[model samples]
Target chain A: MRYTRLSRKKRSIFGSVQLWLGDDHLLVVRSMRFTEEYRRFHLRDIQAITATEQPQLIWMEVALFAISALAFLMMLEVEAIAARIFFGVVGAALASTAVYDLVRGQRCRCRLLTEVSSEVLDPITRVSDFDRLTTQLEPAIAAVQGVLTVDAASMPVFAQPAPGTPPLRQEDRVETPAGKYIPLLLYFAILANAIAYAAGLLGRFNEGFGAAASFWFTEVILCVLLAFQPRRFGLKGPMLGFFYVTAALIAIDGIVTIALIVDLMQRIAEAGRSGTKTPTIWNIEWMMTAGKIAIAGRSLLGVVGLLALWLGRDRVVPASEEVPPSQPQP
Target chain B: MTGDLRCDSCQGGIPPELWNQQQGALCPYCGKRSWTRVFPAIQHTVAGQSPEAIGSESESSCFFHPRSRAIVACDSCGRFICGLCDLDTGSTGGHICPTCFTSPKAPGSGTLLDKRRVLYDSILLGLNLGGFFFFFWPSLITAPLSIVLAIWYWRKPRSIVPRYTTFRFVLVIVLGLLQTAIWIALFWSVANSPGRGSRGPAL
Candidate 1:
């Protein structure tokens, strides 16, 4: 059957709607008003759609997780000093990525709306088919859009709901503004940890301890809360919640490594002051042991979650095939 | 589908090849309909450095007319500032463009140092040449006033005119310190030396 691609500029009493007909010719109407549009589409109209890949965002996220994983691995190595250096590098990388992602994500989404499409459409129609579409198509669409666009008065389309409509419900899968801050906070924590670790390496032992604690309490704590809340509080679906939580756990592991390095530095400083062969004030072995345990626990959990997501990717609902009547039914 | 494709809104003809390029096609005229049988070539535009490259240049237009270009450069930031951006400095030839000059340079700027050095030298000259007169009552007040003026101006911000130089900073610190040292030496010498007048009981 032949499918037709249609795009209509819709303006209601409330706001504008940008519609996209996918390759499958499935109509995906993104209303500026709600997380989910009230209008439904007949699946037969869609042929297929090219997906947007958010590689910049995803790669950035993955890179951070990888660095955290590398830091954890370093802790397991025989050379304690080398492990500390690795941990510091990892902390710095994580923090940098977090900050970049947070700022970039906002800017990207903003730009995407203004520069690319005011609204996006996927060909899949049924809710059960979303998994296939998100995995196969959403990333492609994100890639095409590149960074989010911004104008003087407003951000990109998808960043917020349409004007004159009630706010998105908590149950909808859309990201809340508060959720955007999670990555930024994570990045800050990483930055703090990096500074502290550097100080330890430089032999400024006192400053290092202060830096580590500050990062742990501020960045790590916030990340942990962001990670746990979406699932613990049932704020969002398991897919998105998993991404946030896993990313947070990985970031926390990076922070813990920095703390352990601080402990080691303190011990070394004490040894120098006492002119002793072995330090009595602090135990390097115990600190290393604690770090290993944290890394192992977080990484294991993250790996499991990632695998589960990959496996369950096929079950998501696809966009529906039925097109709604042009006029509202009386 | 085999015939010439036309945009529904504008009735403009679409290239036949575009219909076969991808799964969906975009209309060239109204840009509304997507052709399901064909995709179009993705056109990319390279951005170049244009008049918009400098944002501030656009904002600071001519004061008299909003549309005119700002012809003058602000001594600060080297930005093109309009007539409205100009500010007057109190000194002779002290007209400072507002965009460049704000408050006086910090103590570290060379210009502030030069002014300070000049003030310091004037104080030393007054104190040394007029110290003998100060032995009498009237000259002492002028001497004290000169000293107070030197100190007061020394702490103030530098002038907008005659932009500050680095050498002036070093010169001021050195000259101020040397003058103070000399004044102390003179005071000590006169105070501690054997008294010409015997106010005390005869030894």
Candidate 2:
């Protein structure tokens, strides 16, 4: 209950944040230029302190393994010494990257009995620093709790507040990280739409406007969805307003494209029946079998991408992550 | 439930009868000058639900625990889940399995389900600053996006945390308008240059 400040120290955060260690509570205060925020947790509430190492070599390991596999597979064609040595070098590098990944890149987290967990301190990249930091914090927390102390008659410790002391921060709403890759999938769909459009342009849409309209229509849809992502995540209000506007735009484009496709197909049918098709029409990629194939492939990718977003809808966690797992029921 | 309160200093439980004593009466347990108060009564109610156990081959089993009974199916993936596997979807009003809830692509995408988000205000401010510090013609995209984002999300919810403020929204608009004005002036000057359009085509 004591609001008197004992000691204050600057901690690692986005801005000038301070850690105020008081008689019985640890208060963390942070603020941007205009806004300020703080959270207070009772000393006795913390349950566990964990130091986790997260290495940054998972991507490199995967890339190197693929290269190693490719090199090893090539050994069947060329039995030369260079091929064998190349495979050995890649294979070694991949193994070493995997080892480094396992051995390095760790972060620390503090678990509290109040159903919340957070990385109180900055991430520790080194093993020695990790150990030292945890040692410093564990004892400090125990000292404040009045239960565990280094000395039996330690300097008449801080007053032991009651067990039911209320914490300032009861809960934090964190967004899940479920459909994070949706943007990438939507981008791929956009790329597919671009290729389809290019094919339609090559097909000379003056004769068959349907092909060009459909491809461009699909492209517009991808753009709308991409723009809608931010609002879908957490950006609400006017961001949502633009989202609906974008949806309307895509819908209008869809309807127009459908009409164009129908008209273009009708023209093509009429041209074939009358044997009046332009000679250049045959050379157009959008009109050819290959163009249709590309269009089909891109459509499939777009569908799959949308499916991924739909499935991973509930997986977004807030940007400021640290919520720990809830305790299991007895 | 006993109508008693625990001492703030020593955590000694004091019964309701103790409230009739002096304002700063000495507690017999800790000998601390404690102040006893009568708090509003609380009615505690405990309810229970029996989770169905995984039975024969015909019955569904919990996804997390194979032996536990499948009481509720995950609303997201429709996978049969046990009571232990059921986690509250916060404000989403449903129960989901740990796997689907934690996954970044399982479709539980909402404000409650999101782990982190690209703060629109931050992006808007950054764009405004970028445009202001270097408001060249090439910052057309950044300037427009800054203005749009600032105006659009002006009244939107900022962060899930209640401590933040959206004062940056004004800064973004101010900076963005300044940058846009500079670009407009530059374009106007270029357009009115005596030689630009005049020299384009003598043909």
- In terms of DockQ, the best-performing candidate is 2
The CAPRI class of candidate 1 is incorrect
State TM-scores per candidate.
Answer: 0.25, 0.30
DockQ of each: 0.01, 0.01
Q: State the lDDT of candidate 1 residue by residue for B49-87, as single tens digits.
A: 122222465466644345545655544344454545544
Q: What are the root-mean-square deviations of the candidates from the true structure over C-alphas?
A: 23.8, 29.6
Superpose all Cα atoms of candidate 1 onto the true structure and report the RMSD in Å to 1 decimal.
Answer: 23.8
The local lDDT score (0 to 100) that residue A170 gets in candidate 1 is: 23
What shift in Å separates residue A12 of candidate 2 from its native position after superposition? 5.8
For candidate 2, write residues A56-114 as lDDT tens digits. Answer: 34355445434544444443335688876876576556645543443332222222122
Question: For model 1, how does the per-residue alpha-carbon lDDT over A299-325 read when each residue is reduced to its tens digit?
Answer: 455456445544543322122311111
Question: Model 2 reaches what TM-score against the true structure?
Answer: 0.30
Regions more than 4 Å wrong, model 1? A1-235, A239-259, A278-285, A318-330, B1-203
Residue B191, model 2: Cα distance from true site in angstroms: 4.2
